[model samples]
Target chain A: MNRKKENGLSSEKVFNFCNCAFLLVLVVIVAYPLYYVLIASISDPYEVYAGKTFILPSKVTFEGYARVFREESIARGYLNSIYYTVLGTLVSVALIITTAYSVSKKTLPFKKTIMVFYVITMYFGGGLIPTYLVVSRTGLLNSVWSLILPGGVAVYNVIVARTYFENSIPEELYEAAAIDGSSNLGTFFKIALPLAKPILAVMVIFTMVAYWNDWFTALIYMGEKSKYPLQLALRQILIQSQATATMMGNMDGGYAEANKITELIKFASIVVGAVPMLIAYPFVQRYFEKGFMAGAVKG
Target chain B: MKKGKQGNTNAAVPKESLWKQVVKHWEFYVLLLPGILVTIIYKYIPIYGIQIAFRDYNAVDGFFGSAWVGLKWFQRFFGNYNSVRMIRNTILLSLYSILWTFPIPIILALLINQIRQKRFQRVSQTILYAPHFISVMILCGMLRIFLSPYGGLINILGEALGFIREPVNLIDSASAFRTIYIASSIWQDAGWGTIIYISTLSSVDASLHEAAKVDGANAIQRIMHIDIPELIPVIVIQLIMSFGNLMNVGFEKAYLLQTSLNKETSEIIATYVYEQGMLKAMYSFSTAVSLFNTVVNIILLVAVNKICSKLSDVSFV
Candidate 1:
C-alpha cells in the first residue's frame, strides 16, 4: 500500500508538472500575437517585417502611432465608435434589464407567452437582407440610430439577466417590498436594480465589447465613410488597403518605403483599435466569469 | 377566523382576467413595452418582410406592390453556377471548424482544472481569454500581416527554420482559406469557450476526486472517471448548439479574410447573401438565398436537438 501510494504521488507530480507546462505554452500561444503586435507597432517597420524584433523591439519609433493619430478618418472613427459603444450599451442594458425584470416576475400577465416571443427569435430570424431592408425603409440608414436601435436587445443577454434575477434575488425581498406598499417599479428600481450590479456589469461589458467590435452593421447601414466605426475604419486600412494609400500618398518616399510605413501603420491601428477592450478586460474578467458560470449552470 | 376567511375567499376567487392582471401590473407592462416594440419593429417586421422572397422586390414598387414570383428567386439561386460551390463551402467550413475547434476547449478546461496552483491557473486563464476581445477585422489584419509573402512572420520563421525556400501567400490561397479560418477561430475563441466547461468542472464534487484517489486511482484515472463524466452533459449540449449553428458561420471574419483569390473557398452563404444583396443590390434574389439559409439553420437545429435527446437523453432546445 505504501509503495502504491508513493507511485500515485509521483504520477500526480508528473501530471501537475505536465499540466503547468502545457498551460504555459497555451498562454504564450494566445498572448504572443498581441505582444508581437505591440512590439511591431513601435519597432521600425522594416525590422518588424524582417522579423528581427521578435524578442525586443529594434529601432523603436513612434512614427506609426504618429501617422495613425494624424489620419483624419481614423480619429473620426474612434470618436464615432466611442459614441456608439456608450449609447448602444446603455440602451441595450436598460432594455435587457427592464424586459428581463418584467419577465422574471411571476405575476406578469402572459409571462410565458412573452418569454416565448423573445426565445423564438433565438431559433429563427428573417436573415440579413430583410432586416437591412427594414432598417432602410424605416429611414435609419446612414444614421447613428441605425447602429444603436436595431440590434439593441440581445435576447440571450435578456434570458441570462432574467435567470440571474430569478435565481439570485430572493422572492421574499420583493414580497417584503410589496408589503411595505412599494410599487412594482419602485421595487425594481430601489431593490432589484441595486442587487443586480454584478449582472449589470456583465451586461454592460458584453454589450460594450460587442458594440465596439461591430463593423458589419456599419458596413451595411452607413453610406457615408465619415460615420464608419473604428472597426470599419480599421478594415479600410488593414483589409481593403484603401486608406493606407491615401494616408501614405503625401510621404516623400519610394514604393518600398511607403510599403514599410503602411505595414507599420496597420500594426499601430490594430493596437489602437484593440487596446481599450484589452485594458478593460482585466477589471471586468471577474464579473464576466461569474456571469458565464451563472449562464452555464442554468442553461 | 377572519384571516382564514380572507385567505379562503382569495383562493376561491376566480383568477383575474388577462387584461385586468395586465392593468394591475401596468408598470411591468410599461417596462416591457420598449423591448416588445423593438422586437416587433426590428425582428418581426423583418420576418414580415420575408415575403419579398416570393416577390420581385424593388425600392420603387415597395414590398407589397412588387410582383409575386413563386419560387422564382429560389429556383434562380439553385440554378446559379456558384450555388453548389457556395453550399459546399459553407457546409465544409462549418463542419471542419466544428471538427477542429469543438474538442479543444474541453481539453483545455480539463487541463486547466488539473493545475494545482490557483494563481497560476487564474493568470494563465486571463491570458488565454484575452484574444477573444480582439476584433475580427484586427484578427484578419493580423492574419494578413503574419501570412504575407513579403517578410511575413510565417515565412520568416519558415525560412529560418528551413521549412520552406520561399514565402507563401496563405491569405490569398484558396486551399489555405479554411485552415486559416479554423485555426484563427480556435486561437480566438478556444480560450473563451473553455469558460463554460471550466465553470462546469469547478462544480464537480471534491469528494468524487478524493474517493477515487483513495481507491488507488491515479490522476489520469481519476480525471477519466470523474471529470469526463461530469463534463459529458455540458459537452452534449454544446455539441448540439454547435450543430444547430452549423449553417450560421460568421460572415464578418470570412468576408474580411476573403481576397479575390480566396473567394472560391471563402464564399459561404452569409457572405454570398451580403455580396448579392447589399453590394450588388439584387434584393429579391438575396432575400430568397438568405431565407433558404435560415430555413436550413432551423431544420438543423431541430434535427440535432431531436437526435441528441434520443441518443443520449441529453439535449438543448
Candidate 2:
C-alpha cells in the first residue's frame, strides 16, 4: 500500500511538471512572434530583410515611425477610424443595453416572442448581395452612416448582454426600486444600469475593437479615399508596398530606397494600428476576461 | 351555459391583463424602438429582398420591377465550372479549421487550470489572447513578412535547423495557403476560445477531484474522470453552435489573405459572392449562390443540433 502511494505521488509530480513545461512552451510560441514584430518595427529595414533582427534590433531607427506619420492618408485614416469607433460603440452599446434590459425582465409581456424575433437572425440572414442592395437602395453608400448603421446591433452581443443582465443583476434590486415609486425605465436607468458596469465595459471594448478593425464595410460602402478607415489605409500601404517591391524588381537597386521605406513602414503601420488596443489592454484586461466569461457561460 | 360564460370571462381577463402589462412596460417598449427599427431595416428588409435571388436584379428595374427568373440563376451557379471547387474549398476549410483549432483550446484551458501559480497563468493568458485583438490587415501583413522567402524568421530557422536546403516562398504557394491560414487562425482564436472552457472548469467541483485523489487516482486519471466529463457538455455545445455557420467561414481573413497565386485555394464562397455581386455586378447570380450557402448552413445547424440533442443532453437550441 505504501509502495502504491509512493508511485501515485511520483506520477502526479511528473504530470504537474509536464503540464507547466507544455504551457510555458505555448506561451513562448504565442508571445515570441509579437515580440519579434515589436523589435522589427524599430530595427533597420535592411537588417530586417537580412534576418539579423530576430532577437534584437540590429540598428535602432525611427524612420518607420517618421515615414508612417508623414503619410497624409494615415492621419486621415486615424481620425476616420476614431470617429467611426466612437460613434459606432455608442450606438451599438446603447441599443444593446436597452434591448437586453427589456428582454431580461421576466414580467415583460411577450418577452419570449421578442426574444424569438432577435434569435432568428442569428441562424439565418439576408445574404451579402441582398444586404448590399438594401444599403445602396437606402442611399447609404459613401457615407459614415453606412458603416455604423448596417451592422449597428450584433444579435449575439445582445444575447450576451441579456444574459449578463439576467444573471448578474439581482431581481430584488429592481423590486426595491419599484417599491420606491420608480418606473421600469427609471429602475433601469437609476438601478440596473449602474450595476451593469462590467458588461458595459465589455460591450464598449468589443464594439470599439470591432469598429476599429473593420475595413470590409469601408471597402464596400466608402468609395472615396478620404473616407477610408485605418485598416483600409493600412491595406493600401500593404498593396503599395507589394506593388513597389514588384516594380522595383526589374529596376534592380534603383528603387531600393523606396522599397526600404515601404518595408519599414509595413512594420510601423502594424504597430500604429495596434497601439490603441495594446495601450488599453492592461486596463481592460480584467473586464475582458469577465465579459467573455459572462457572455460565453451565460450565453 | 354558466361554464361558457366563465370561459369567456377568463379569456377577457387575460386580454385585459396583457393590455395592462403593455401599458405598464410602455417605457421599456419605447426604449426598444431603436433596436426594433434597426433589426427590421437592416436584418428583415434585406431578408425580404432575398427574392432578388430569383429575379434579374437590375438597378434600373429595382427589386420588384426586375423580371422573375425563378431558379435560373441557381441553375447557372450549379452548372458553373468552379462550383464544385468552391464547395470543396469551403467545406474543407471549415472542417480543417475545426479539426485543427478546436482541440488546442480545450487542452490549453486544461493546462491553464492546472497551473499552480496564479500570476503565471494570468500573464500567459494575456499574452496568448493578444493576437485575437490584432486587425486582419495587420495580421495578414505580418504573415506575409514572416513567411517571406528571403530572410523571414521561419525560413532562417528552417535553414539553420536543416529543415530546408533553401528558403521557400511560403506565402505564394497554393498548397501552403491552407496551412498558413489555419495556423494563423488558431494563433489568433485558440487562446480566446479557451476562456469559455476555463470558465466551465471553474464550475467543476473541487471535491470530486479530492475524491478521485483519495481513490488513488493520479492527475491524469482525475482529469479523465472529472474534468473531461465536465468539459464535454461545453465542448459539444460549442461544436453544435459552430456548425450553424459551417458554410460561413471568416470572410474578412480569407479575403485579406487572397493573392493572385493563392486565388485557387482562397476563392471561397464569401469572396466569390463579393466578386460577383460587388466587383462584377452579377447581383442575381451572386445572391443565388449566397442564398444557397445560407440554406445549407441552416440545414446543417438544425441537423447537428438534433443529432447532438439525441446523442447527449448538450445542444444549441
Candidate 3:
C-alpha cells in the first residue's frame, strides 16, 4: 500500500513537471514575437537585417520614433483614431445599456419581438454592397458619422448586457422601487444603471478596442487621407508601402540609406500603434475575464 | 348593461388595457427608441437593399427602378471560373482553422487548471492573451517583416539551423498562405479563448478532485475522469458556437495578407465580394454571391445545431 502511494506521488510529480514545461514553451512562443518587435524597433536596421539583434538590440537609436512622429499623415491618423475610439465607445455603450435594460424587464411590451428584430441581423446581413450603398446614399460618405453610426449597436453586446441584467439584478429590487412609486425610467436610471458598473466597463473596453482597431469602415467611407485612422495609415505604410516613398522624399538619404530607415520606420510605427492597447491590456484583461465569467455563467 | 359589467370587473381587479399598459411603460419604449431606430436604419435598410441583388442595379435608376433579372447574376457568378476556387478556399481555410484552433484552448485550459502555483498560472495567462490585443494590420505587418526573403527572421533562423540553404519568400508562397493565416489566428486567439473554459473549470467542485485522489486516481486519470467531464458542456457549447460561424472566416486578415502571388489561395468569398462589389462595381453580381454565402452559413448553422443537439444533448441556438 505504501509503495502504491509512492508510485502515485511520483506520477503526480512527473505530470506537474510536464505541464509546467509545456506552458513555459507556450509562453515563450506567444511572447517572443512581441519582444522581437520591440527589440527590432530600437535596434539598428542594418544589425536587425543581419540577424545580430535577435537576443539583444545593437546600435540602439530613437531616429525611427522621431521620424514616425515627424510624419504628417501618421500624426493626423493618430488624432483621428483617438477621436473615433472615444466617441464611438460612448455611443455604443449608451445604446447597448439603454436597450438592454428595457429588454431585461419582464413587463416590457413586445419584448420578444424587439429581441427577435435585433437577433435576426446576427444570422443574416444584407451583404457588403447593399450596406455600402445605404451608407453612401445617406450622405454619410466622407463623414465621421459614417464610421460612428453605421455599426454602432452590436447586438451580441446588447444580449450579454441583457443577460447580466436578467441574472444578476434581482426582481425584488425592481419590485421595491415600484412600491415606492418609481417609474420604469426612474428605476432604470436610479437602480439599474448604478448597479451595472461592471458590465458597463466591459462594454466600454470592448467597444473602445473595436473602434480603435477598425480600419475597414474608414477604408470604405472616407476617401481623404487626412481623415484616415491609425490602422489605415499603418496599412499604407506597412502593407501597401505607398506612404514610405513619400515619407522618404523629404529626408536627406540615398537609396540604400532610405530603404534601411524605411524598414526601421515600419517597426517603429508598429510599436507606436500597438503601445496604447498593450498599456491598457492588464486592466482590460481583469475586467474582460470578469465580463466573460458573467457571460458564461448563464449564457 | 355592458358598461356596468366592465366597470364591475375593473373595480374587482384593476386590470389595465393593453394601450394603458403601453402608455404606463412609455419610458421603457422611449429607452428602446434609439436602439430600434439604429437597428431599422443600419440593419433593416441594408436588408431592404438586398433586393438589388435580384435587380440590374444602376445608381441612376435607384433600387426600386432597377430591372429585375432573376438568377442572372447568380448564373454569372457560378459561370465564372473563380467562383468554385473562392468557395473552396473559403471552406478549406475555415475547416483547417477550426480543426487546428478549436482543441487548443481546451487543452491549454486543462493544463492551466492543473498548475499548483496560482501566480505562475496568472502570469502565463496574461502573456498568452497579450497577442489578442494586437491589430490585424500590425500582425500582417509583422508577418511581412518576419517572412521577408531579404534577411527575415525566419530565414535567418533557418540558415543558422541549416534547415534551408536559401531564403524563401513565405508571404508570397501560395502553399504557405493558409498555414501562415491559421498559425497567426491561433497565436492571436487561443489564449483569449481559454477564458470561457477556465471560467467553467473554476466552477468545478474541488471535492471531486479530492475524492478521485483518494480513490488512487493519478493526476492524468483524475483530470480525465473529473475535470474533462465537467468541461464537456462548455466545450460542446463552444464547438456549436464555432460551427455557427464556420463560413465567416476572418476577412480582414485574409485581405491584409493577400499579395498578388498568394491571391490564388487567399481569394475567399468575403474578399471576393469586397473586390467585385466595391472595387470593380459589379454590385449586383457581388451581392448575389454574398447572399449565396449567407444562405450557406445559415443552413450550416442550423444543420450543425441539430446534429449537436442529437449527439450531445447540449446545443446552442
lDDT at B311, model 3: 78
lDDT (Cα, 0-100) at A123 in candidate 2:
76
Deviation from native of the Cα of residue A278 in model 2, angstroms: 2.2
Off by over 4 Å in 1: A244-246, A297-299, B1-14, B314-317
- In model 3, the fraction of reference contacts reproduced equals 0.78
Tens digits of per-residue lDDT for model 2, B1-317: 43344355345544445678689789989988898888888889889889999999888988889999899999998899998888888998998988899899999898888887788888888888888888888888888878888667789778878999999998888898899999999998899889888988988889988888889988777778788888887888888877767899888878877888887888898889999998999999999999998988888998997888798843333
Docking class of 3: medium
What Cα-based lDDT does every candidate model obtain?
0.89, 0.84, 0.89
DockQ of 1: 0.74
* Model 2, C-alpha of A194: deviation from truth (Å): 0.6
lDDT of 3 by residue, B226-261 (tens): 888888888888788888998899999999999999
Tens-place lDDT digits, model 1, residues B1-317: 43343345456656666578778899998999999998899888888889999999988888788999999999999999999999999999999999999999999999999988999999999989999999999999999999999978889889989999889988899999999999999999999999999998999999988988888888789889899988888899889889999999988899989889999999999999999998899999999999999899888999997898797843323
Off by over 4 Å in 3: A249-253, A297-299, B1-15, B314-317
The full ranking of all candidates by DockQ, starting with the best, is 1, 3, 2
Q: For residues A1-299, could you state the per-residue lDDT of candidate 2 as single tens digits?
A: 99999999898888888888888898899888888888888999888887788788989998778777877778899999999999888988999999999988776777878889988887777878788888888899998889988884678888899898888888788878877899888898888899998899999998889999999989999999998999888887764354333322333355576667667778888888888887787788888778877887443
Candidate 3, clashing residue pairs? none
Best by DockQ: 1
